[model samples]
Target: MKFSQWIGFTILAFCVYILWNIRQLLLLLFTAAIIANFLNHGVQLLQRIGMKRGSAVLSSILLSLIVLSGFFLIIIPPFAEQLPELFKLVSLGLDQLILTIKDFILRLDPELIKALPNSQQVVEQLEPLIQIIAGQGLSVFYTTLGIPLTLLLLFALTLMLLVNPSAYRQGFIRLFPSFYRKKIDHILTECDRSLQGKLTRILFKMVMITMLSFIGLSLLGMRLTLAQSMLAGILTFIPNIGPVLSLIPPVAIALLENPWKSLSVFVLYIIFYLVISIIESKFVAPLLIENRKSILPAVTLLAQVFFGISFGVLGFFLALPLALVAQVWLKEVLVKDILDQWKSNYNYSHQEFTSELKKK
Candidate 1:
């Protein structure tokens, strides 16, 4: 193709290379920005209640810390204690499940059962996989020790952003061409509004859903209902895969206690998830994102996975907003102005051709 196109492609590739090299830093910055955006809402509310900006920020930070600490206190120890045992139990459960499957298959289809790998062999193969996951889990635990440092950085950045949001907005807008800056500004404002509303609704709904899940699981006599419920609720933020992963722990716990009881709990979880998901899709999402277009669910999920893979847990958490930002940029800037221009010109030419034919 054209030399200009080649140059553009090269530039794009170079930029991507640079981004990949500095992905960790970019992830940290994005994480800070997301936290700042959420906390900015609290700072604004506190300001409305007659607090100064600094005081509001400080209060919001402290409150966040308290909530986080309380959550850790309630959830972490039991999780730490039970998680290892849960893994061991799950391995045993899988072995038993495989054996049951093999027995049933042998009765129904002897050839098929013979073709399958032995249950004991399968279990042996899984041992290495389990060890790798356990190692990763330990890594995660150690990584968590850096959380206070991360939070401090986030708080400092957030305070700066809240103290003078306009400055940051203007700085970002200036990165674009002068002709596009105004449009970019509008897009940023719209994104901020959309995210604020969506996140608030999500947080509130998650809390209610978690509470209901906890109560339901508790009623069903599931162990660690509170912890599992909290996990299930938090995972809901990740979209499609989250609920499934969340259900696994409780279902396994139920199975360990009693097979029939686990089956009941599993069925209950499926029903509950279906109902809640329907309600969320039909009512909650629409209400939260009223008048604000969002990226497709598939795109959102892909972005989360991509970011999560590249940058780990923090990346996963910030993926949605980052994807939203990318979507807004594509739609408002690239699609509307650049791509639509070609379509508009083509339509105009077609109209002219039709007029000439009519005259002829």
Candidate 2:
């Protein structure tokens, strides 16, 4: 490579290195941007209804806080009360399971007992996990929910963005070449609209899942139906693995009640997951995005896995939206404009459009 090309490559590598180092912070900022984008819609609506910009922003923030406060009120208390019980029940369930195993083992031939899983050894392996849950389940649960300081920092950044989004937007657009700034701005707008549709669809899915889970749990006579159903709903915001996480609490409680019923609970949740997936893919999604081409399941799963590995939990939470942003830019800029426009650059007879025109 030429000396100048080498220099440019080194600078690009350094930039990527810096970005990698700050990836977590970038994810956090992106999260804040998403929140701000949604809030901005409310601010825009209020402004259209004759409120001043300042009043609209303030009202939007206040309204957001109210909704958040209500969400916490609904979630926190139920989880606080049920979590410990859930943990205790899970512990008892394990013990009961071990007892059943032991009894079966005692009835079996001594050689066969040795061949099968030893109840005592199984308990020894699971002992630490059971102890941790019994000892610090609530702390773990709350920590997973999030730390207050981190959440505060997140919202503060969101407010900053929400206050004057257009300024940040234009500043970002200015970073592109003058000739391409318009195109960049248009791409950003597309991303924003795509993101809004995704967020709305996600919210719709959450509500539907919550309702469906609640009724399913009730029909199955599951313990702590409300808390488990609510958990199912909230976790629906996450992509692939959320359903698995939501399955744990009910299954644990079911195990405590009856080992066989735990199997039933497991099967029931699998059904609910499938039902919700079908409902969203068939009904909710199309209404949310007009002419929305179906995204590949493998691609969505790949995004979840890639983001979860790269960005940890935050990436998993934002995976779909992040993927949405990438998809919009790639589709509009690369596939539609660059690739399609560049087709004329080739004089190959194998080109279908050119060949068809010649045939005509």
Candidate 3:
């Protein structure tokens, strides 16, 4: 390559390296952006009803704070009190389950029992590996011991962004060449709309799941039903694997009391989740987000692994949102414009683009 070309390549590589080093900060900023977007919708709604921008933003922030405070006040105290009992129940449940399994094995033929490998020996061999993995995971979390500070920074940033979102949006647009600024602005608008729709759908699903789980657990007379349901609801944000993890605590506690009750709890969770899933797929999503493409489960899992490794637990949680945003940009800029229908000039006018975007 020519010397100028080599210099350009070197500059690009250096920029990438710098970005990689500060990726965590970027993720936090992205999170703030998502929060700002969610809040911005509320601001816009208030504006439509004749409220000024500042008042609208303030009202939205106050509303969010009120909801959060109410949730913590209602849920945290009881959950904290019951935590010890919950752990004790889990231990008893495991013991009872093991005994039941042993009794079943004893009824099997002597030769069949003899052929079975020793579970204790297998566990012993796996213990060190499990401990190592767990230690590494804990260490990663320890490295993020300042997460509260990070969260504070994020909240502050979101507030600042909310106060003058147009300034930031315009600043971002100004970063591009003058000719491409319109297209970039259009793309950003699309991304914001997509993220808004995704979050709305998720929040709706979470509320539904929490209510259904709570109702089901109450009917079954399960202890800690509120805490269990809330946990289930929050974890439902994680997609495919979340519902299974959510079932473990309640099912284990129930199993300690009655095997039949344990089975019923499991069935109840499955039915509730299945119903929610069907409604979400069939109705809720189509009504909420008609324009955005769904993120595939496999892609979501891959994003989780990548973000989890790169940014730890917080990253793992934000993986879906990050992936969703990335998918939007990739589809609009890379796939649609560059790959699928690359055209030179083609009389691309702002009005024509706006018309096309509206149709989309």
Candidate 4:
């Protein structure tokens, strides 16, 4: 490589290194941006109904808070009270399951019975896995502790963005050379549309999944029905893996009843999610999101794995929106502009568009 090319490469590497170090803050900012984008959508809707911008933003925020507060009020106390009982039930269920398995093994072969680990031995074997789960629980505890302060910062940032989003939009455009600014602005619009569409669809899925899960579990006479259903609903926001994770708790509880009951619970979850997935892929998504295609399941899972490794839990939470944003920029800047070598109006009319936007 030429000396200048080598120098540019080093600079790019340094920039990436710096970004890696500041990834947490970047994730936080991006999260705030995503929230701001959704709130901005609400603001736009309110504006169309003849509300002022400030009132619209305030109304949107307040409406969200009211809904969240209502759920917390209704659910938190019951969930907390039932949690210990749920754990006890799971432990009892697991013990009975182990005993049953041991008896089955004994019937098969006396020697196999002797080889099979008893409950205490099995617990010892699971020590590491239990410790890992405990550590994760602690991490969740710490995250919960910090949520208030984090939400404060997030809300503040979101409010600032909502107040004058066009300024940020224009400023970002200015970072590019004047020739590419229009194209970049167009790209930003595409990102906005994509984010909005994904967010809308995700919210709808959450509601539907939660409702379906609750109804199904209730019909099956599952304990902690509310908790399981709400958890399933919330986790549905995490694509591909969320439904599987949501299955664990109810299945464990069912094991307390009997193996057949456990199997029934497992089968119920499978059928419920299959129905949800079919309906979503066939009708809901196509009806709701008009512009962009849904993220491929492989792509969503890959993003989750990559981001989870890179940034931990926060990464998993923000993975889909992050993937959507990355996809937009990648498609527009890399594939279209660079690889495809698309012709640009910069050859003839760059100033015309910039001036018109500036006047607006």
Candidate 5:
């Protein structure tokens, strides 16, 4: 390789090393960027209505605050009321289930019934694990409380970006070689368009699914339908595992009400989710994405699990978008340039071989 090419490769390698080392910071910044983009869209809409940019940004921020407050107001009370009751019911039902299992065991083999551990003793043995699980749950709740702070920082950064997006654009453009800057800019624009389109459509679909789930569960007389449905919809972004998580609350409640009812509710939930997911995977997502490429759903979900484990709840929420960004970078920069070069080299050697064969 030429001296300049070697130097460029070294610099790129160094940058990659730095990025790997500071991935947490990068994640936070990426999340901020997404929030900024959403805020910018809202501000732009207000601007189209003849509002001044400053006024538009301020109004957008205020509107966001109102929406968030309203969401919390709607969600919290029902959750608080249902959680304790749900836990009590779960404990009682578990005890009853154990008794039923023991009775069946006695009927099948009298000796096996004597071998079974007392239910209370088993529960005592499991207490530490249960406490650990509850601790993790509380940590999630604490992380959620940080959302307001995150939003504040995001809004402040967004206002600055909205006020002068060109400054950041120019800075980013300057990071590339002069020959590639314009191409990079165009790629960035395409990415923004793709991300924005997909995000909006996906959010809308999730909301629709949530509402439908709520209505169905309510009609079925399930407890905490609203909260459960809302949670299910929100977690839908997590792909394969999301619907399963959503099913737990309703199924647990049903089990508490009656084992047979729980089995029926489980079947109904499975059917409902199957139909919804099929429509989403086959039609909705494809239409929204249109001919645009995206990361594999499996890769996206795996990334979510990895990030959620490492960084907790914030990571979970940001995982899919981060995966999407990584996919775009890999496709545009790595595959297009590096892999295409390798392909060209292969083609050249093949053509030379064919020419030599003809001469032979």
Candidate 6:
């Protein structure tokens, strides 16, 4: 309407355009922030036990490094060695499965036998899509192309943020007006808490899934059970979809080991999934997170699409947590404060004017 208003709009649009252009860097920063937050909790814990801040931070970093080292060392080497055999077993399993299906169809109806899709053709069609999805997911953590550099930067940024979080927190608060600084600080705290709770929930699922899968797979006499279970646990980070994918390799191996055992392995996974889901829903979630505002499956899928598009593979992996953080901020700052207050403020003003008129 006014020149100042037009100028303000232009500036705001320009800022958004700038932000869009640098989104990748922003995402990397966000990833760093999430890592920092996770580490910060460890730092806080150490501090509570009389450790100094610097030592706590360094200890947290080293502890993370140790954990990661253990994962790669213990998990990767065995998986790498078994990979070829695993693939062969999987192929055999698929072939056997197809044959079994064909035989079943032939018994039920001769016509249905001719209609059965060729497994080779289906695999060929799916191969490229699977490669792309897997590649992208892998890129989130490491790509041979960017391996050390990207990860180095990520860790470096995380350490910097973790080292002096209050400075960054205050810097962010200072962006707002003096009067609103306190409110912004409060909102940031809420986001921190929300993110921490989400991280805790995911970690719980990972540990439980890993332990259960190991025990169940071992009982089934599967090869490489520990590595497979570890993979399953890590895959739990991907939410509903990941655990399902994790089942494929083991199920195929089970089938190759013993066709009958395939069914047993499958049943075990289902039972464990049900058990884990119930515990999370009934106890872990409630204890960790105050607001159990469910993340709908549809919304989760949409988050994958949006983040995957915006940030690529890395975005896809971080989508759930990013969505969670965004949800908290939007609810607290936008919906609760801005949108919800509008009508109430309007009603209050109207009532005040009415009172003045009656007094007059």
Winner of 3 and 5 under lDDT: 3
Tens digit per residue, CA lDDT, model 1, 270-294: 7876777688777777665332675
Q: Write the per-residue lDDT of candidate 2 for residues 1-360, one digit (tens) a residue.
A: 999999999999999999987676777789999999988988998999999999999998888889889978987788778867766776677667667766787787556656676666888997765554343323322544456766787889999999999999999999878999999998998888788887887788789878888898899888777778887888888766677777777787787777889899889888877887798788877676432643566888888767766776567677889888888888988998898788453556458677898899
TM-score rank order: 6, 3, 4, 1, 2, 5
Among the numbered candidates, top TM-score falls to: 6
Error at 45, model 4, angstroms: 1.2
Best by lDDT: 6
Q: CA lDDT of 86 in candidate 5?
A: 60
Please state every model's RMSD to the true fold in angstroms: 5.5, 7.5, 9.1, 10.8, 6.4, 6.1
Instruction: Report how far off residue 308 is in candidate 4 (Å).
Output: 0.5
Q: Tell me the tens digit of each residue's lDDT in model 3 across 1-360.
A: 999999999999999999987776777788898899888988999999999998999999999999989978998889778777777877687777767777788887556666665658778997775555444434533455465776688899999999999999999999878998998888887787778778787888789989998898898899888778888888888867777778888888898778999999989888887887798878877776434578898998888777777766667778888888788889878998888886665566877898999999
The Cα local distance difference test for each model comes to: 0.74, 0.79, 0.81, 0.80, 0.72, 0.82
- TM-score of the candidate numbered 6? 0.82
Q: Kindly report which residue stretches of model 2 are placed more than 4 angstroms away from their true locations once superposed.
A: 1-3, 87-148, 259-291, 336-360
- Which pairs clash in model 3? none
TM-score of each: 0.76, 0.74, 0.81, 0.78, 0.71, 0.82
Supply the global lDDT for candidate 3.
Answer: 0.81
TM-score of 2: 0.74
Candidate 3 segments whose C-alpha is farther than 4 A from its true place:
94-148, 281-283, 341-360
lDDT of 4 at 171: 90
Looking at model 5, how many pairs of residues clash? 0
Q: Could you give me the TM-score of model 5 versus the true structure?
A: 0.71
